[model samples]
Target: MKLYYHPLSGHSHRARLFLNLIGAQHELVEVDLMAGAHKKPEFLALNPFGQVPVLDDNGTVVTDSNAILVYVAKKLKLTDWLPDDPVASAAVQKWLSVAAGQIAYGPAAARLITVFGAGFKPEEVITRAHAVLAVIEAQLSGGSFMVAASPTVADVALYSYIARAPEGNVDLQAYPNVRAWLARIEALPGFVEFRKTPVGLAA
Candidate 1:
């Protein structure tokens, strides 16, 4: 298996964390997002969206992070991340939807725009981020984990971006439950430390 990714991308980080959680060995291929490597013909051919976090398992390529999570969770851990009952699975879908929709757009993208020169109004983005965080805070107040009592794909999906919200100047002060959840996630074995927002390349 080959993972084409950028280190700073939260989506890519989720995939990496999931892979690590399951102890799946794979070669890491860093794609230079700064150099427009993802937008180039070669990379676009691999994923039409020209996105990072493309997993090429032999000849099989998975582009979307959520899809890759489902594939990996089902294949690797079996019963751990994915639920069997239809109602329980629907419950999981709720968080997954929030992860891709609210979490991705507001918090994750806001952080990228602020940190990576993606160009967006800071106040506007931060406001949107807070709204997303509010939802998570409410959810965290009720459960030990976002989607389940135990960690699930939904938790893995949102953990990186939510934990790194401070990089976007999005305040976590109001959401103590979420902060606690972040700490819990960090304490989990195989959780790799991620560089939240690298303003510039390190020497």
Candidate 2:
């Protein structure tokens, strides 16, 4: 399997984290987003959206970070990573949605402003980050993991951006539960650190 990704991308890190956790045999192919490599013709052929973190599992191409997580979990028959139970599955999907929506526009977007000079409003995105973090901190108050008693795709989906929220100037210090939760995920076997940016409060 080959993973086309940018090291600093949280979306790329999410997919890469799951692949590592599952002990999947894969090769990393760096896409030079700095050089606009992702926007080139050949790369766009792999994903019309021209994004990093596209997975090529023997020609079975999967794009989008969340979709890639689901695909790899299903392919490996890792029921624990993504349960088949209707309730569990729905719960996981809920957080995955959060990852795509709030997390993306919030912490991830804020980081884009600082790290990549993106045009999003910092105040707006940071507010959104805290709002989403509040919900997650509350949800994790009585549980060790997100959906189930153990780690799920939902956890993987949310982990990267949240862990690196500080890089976006979204402080993690206010939410102790969220901080603890990040620590727990870090202690998990096969866990990989998302490359940190030198900007933001955490830095």
Candidate 3:
């Protein structure tokens, strides 16, 4: 399997993290987003949306970060990462929605502003980040992982951006439970660090 990705992208990191956590053997193909490589004809053939983190599992192609997670977990029959039970599946799906929705516009968008010079309003996205973090804080107060006692795809979906929320100037100090949960995820074997942005540089 080959993962086409950009190092600074949290979405890319999310997919890459899961692969490593599961001990999957894969190759990384870095896409030069700065050089407009993702928009070129060769890359577009893989994903019309022209996005990074496209997974090529031999002949199978998976687009979108969350979709990649689902594809991998189901293909590997990893029920711990993606539950088979209906109610548990729904619970996991709920957080996956949050990862794509609130987490995207909230913390991720705010970080894009600082790291990529994106056009979102700082105050708006930063406020949104805090609001979502508060809910996650409350939810995690009762458990170590989201949706269950063990980690799930939902945890991987939410991990990257929340772990680096401070890069967006969104404070994590207020959410103790959330911080501890982050630590738990970090301590897991086979964990990989999401590349951090330099103090005065944008990747």
Candidate 4:
């Protein structure tokens, strides 16, 4: 398996982190985002969106970070990562949506502004970040993992940007439950980190 990615991208990190967690044999092929390599013809052929973290398993191609997580969990038969129980699976999907929606618009968007000079209002995104964090903190108050007792794809989906929220000046100090959740994920075997940036409050 080959993973086309950029080290600093949280999306890329999510995919890479899961691959490691599952003990999947793979090679990392860094896409030079700095050089606009992702926008080039060759890379676009893999994903027209010109995004990093596209996975190539033999001839099969999987694009989008969340999609890759689903594919890997199913392909590797990691049933625990994605349960068969209807309600449990729906719960997992709910968090995945959070990761893609609120988390994306909030902490992830704020990080983009600082880390990549993306055009977005810091105050707006930071406010959004806290709103999402509040919900997550309450949800995690009595649970170690997001959906089930053990780690799931939902945890993997939300982990990267939330773990790095401080890079966007969104402090994790007030969210004790969320912080504990992050620590729990870090303690898992084969856990990997997203590369840190020297910016924002955490820096």
Candidate 5:
């Protein structure tokens, strides 16, 4: 399997994290996003959407980060990371939606402003980040993870942006449960980190 990705993208990191957590052997193909490589024709053949983190398993391609996670989990039969039962599977799906929705517009958008010079309003996105964190903080109060005692693709989907929320100036200090959850995921075996941008490194 080959994962075509940009290093700074949280979506890319999501797929990479799950692959490592499950011990899936794969190659990382870095796309030069800063140079418009993702929008180029050759890369677009892999994903017409021109997105980072497109997974090519031999000839079968998977687009979207969360979709990649689901593909890998189902392909490997890693039921613990992605459960088989309907209720538990639904629970995992719920958080994956949150990861793509609130987590994207919230913390992820906020960070895009700082790290990528995105035009989103800083105050607005930061506020959105805190709002979602509050709910996540509440959800985690009852359990170690978003779905169950063990980490799942739900956890992987949410981990990258939330872990780096401070880069967007969205303080994690207010969310202790959220902080603890991040630590727990980091402590897991075969965990890979989402790369942090350096100060003044916006491109």
Candidate 6:
């Protein structure tokens, strides 16, 4: 299996984190986004969306970071992260949604725009991103991890962007719980850090 990804992409980070957590072995292929490599015909054939984090498990092309997490955790969790209860399962699903929706669109996207030149309205981006931070802070205030008593695909899915959120200029001064949760994930074994610096934080 070969994972095609850019170092700076949050979605890509999610897929990478899950692979690392489960100790899955595969080839790591770096995609050069800045050179318009993702737009090329060959890579587009791998992922029609022209996005990062395309996992080629032999012939199976798995796109979307959250979907990759589901595939992997299903194979490996054994209740380690993804529990057995339906309601708790639903909660785990919700966190995955938050990762793809709120986390991707807000802090992750905002950082891309501010740092990578996405050109979205900067103030609007930061404002929305901060709103997500606020909500995550509240969710985590009650538990060590989001949506479960222990780490799940939820933590791996959301970890990279939130951990790197400070580089994107979203304030974390009031998000103590979220910060603590991040620290816990960071402490986990087999955790792989995202390879690139976030966009604006580049010096």
Pick out the ten consecutive residues of candidate 1 with the lowest summed lDDT.
194-203
Q: Candidate 3 vs candidate 6: which has greater TM-score?
A: 3
State TM-scores per candidate. 0.93, 0.98, 0.97, 0.98, 0.97, 0.93
Query: What TM-score quantifies how close candidate 2 is to the native fold?
Result: 0.98
lDDT of each: 0.83, 0.94, 0.94, 0.94, 0.93, 0.82
lDDT tens digits, residues 1-203, model 6? 78998887888888988788778897889999999999999999999999989989879888988888887677665576777789888988888898888887888877777668787786887788899888888888788988777798888888888877766777776788988888898888988887656455443
Which regions of candidate 3 deviate over 4 angstroms? 199-203
Which regions of candidate 2 fall more than 4 Å away from where they truly are?
none
Over 2-50, each residue of candidate 2 has an lDDT whose tens digit, in order, gives: 9999999999999999999888999999999999999999999999999
- What lDDT tens digits, residue by residue, belong to model 3 across residues 114-158? 889999999999999999999999999889999999999999999
> How does candidate 4 score on lDDT?
0.94
What tens digits encode model 4's per-residue C-alpha lDDT throughout 17-101?
9998888999999999999999999999999999988999998999999999999999988889999899999999999999999
- Candidate 1 lDDT (Cα, whole model)? 0.83
At residue 35, candidate 5 shows an lDDT of 96
At residue 142, what lDDT does model 5 achieve?
Answer: 98
Better structure of 1 and 3 per TM-score:
3
Clash totals, every prediction: 0, 0, 0, 0, 0, 2
Residue by residue across 29-112, what tens digits does model 1's lDDT show? 999998999999999999999998999998989998888888877766566688877876787788888889888777776787
Please tell me which model should have the higher TM-score, number 4 or number 5: 4
Worst 10 residues of 5 by lDDT: 194-203
Off by over 4 Å in 4: none
